[model samples]
Target: MSIKIYGDPGSGSLRRITSAAAVMGVEIERVNIDLFKGESHTPEYLELNPHGLSPVMVDGDFVLYESSAINLYLAEKAGSDLAGTTTRERYEILQWMFWSGEQWRVFATLTFDEVLAKRFMGKPADESIVNLAAAKLRAGASVLDAHLAKHDYIVGDRLTLVDFDIAGPFSQNERTKIPLNEFPNLVAWQQRLLETVPAWADTKREVDVRIDTALEAAGIKL
Candidate 1:
């Protein structure tokens, strides 16, 4: 069984998938797609992923998209501890995975596009949009912070798919200049995640370097 992952290094989805593969001790063949050049939107790529997104996974005849879904698939396939063994554990993993995708991704992407992209990448920033995105992100962070206050990991004590799913978007706070002090619990949770999952911290460093390289190549002062 061979696994191929098509994604750009700087993409959040790519970081998540790569981190999952690392944790699962799986070797993945990476096909880098140039986002700025619109390679992902090309006809052939579109045929593989109708959504034209990064981090598409092809495992033998099975093809999948969505970063979280890819991580879950890889974890299950590897029979790693990242995927819970029991039904209850699986459900708990799914719960946090959903929360990460819906809550964290939504706000992080919005704020990144509105504020960070403009400030760091030289994109135009609309004050109104930035303000709105900031408010939404803060609200979402508060939710995660509250939940994290009582739990070390997203799903009870052990690190599972829930923790993997949120790592990418959560790491964005550092680069995107989103303050974590307001969400102390979330900040603490992230630190603990980094400590427990060293691969996550490594992936974060790689992702940061990749993004900086991409921006530098584009002549954007980030």
Candidate 2:
């Protein structure tokens, strides 16, 4: 049975899962979910993921949501070293995944929604919300930058889901007004990771175009 993934192509949350699937040799069927139209609230989608979140995976009779969990499951299903070669390495990857989800992901989402997303939607960003989101983003970046300074990948010397977990959220840093130059290590890590994955380029290009249109429409030069 082919695995089914419900997601929005314009959003990077699900891109990480699909991109990982490609790198791990996991074949999947992608179902586009139009979040702007409230398609996620429809009964069909709610059955798969009641929270109405993107990147729901259905393999055979098993259904799962939450991008990180789906990524973990896909990694194990592929039986690859993405989870980590050793038990300790696997645990460390899990720790970073959780931190990326709880801290990095949250701030990334908030900043985009409050800042870049509003511009994309042809509205002005809420300065107060942007301030808070930017502060949290900087804090998260500091820790990540320090860690990346010592390591190429998040959990180990090689690529892992930990890298994907952290990379996915900040993939659009330049377009979203994220100041990557301030965190040199983090910027370097993100650059190398994206360049290493061939499948990521096209989707990233598409996202870049979207961000460009948004910024232009909002009269904000980047």
Q: How does candidate 2 score on lDDT? A: 0.80
Report, for all candidates in order, the number of backbone clashes. Answer: 0, 0
Question: Where does candidate 1 stray beyond 4 Å?
Answer: 116-122
Give one digit per residue, the lDDT tens place, for model 1 in 1-222.
679999977777788778778878989999889875678899999988988878798888888999888887888778787888888888888887887777767776777777555555456877776677677778878887888988898775778766767656666666666555588888888888788778888887877888777667667753
Estimate, for each residue in 12-80, the C-alpha lDDT of model 2 and write its tens digit.
888788778888999999898766567889998899988978879999899999888998898888898
Which residue segments of model 2 deviate by more than 4 Å?
119-123, 209-222
| CA displacement after TM-score superposition, residue 78 of candidate 1 (Å) | 1.3
In candidate 1, which residue pairs get closer than 3 Å at backbone N, Cα or C atoms, i.e. clash? none
Clashing pairs in model 2, backbone N/Cα/C closer than 3 A:
none
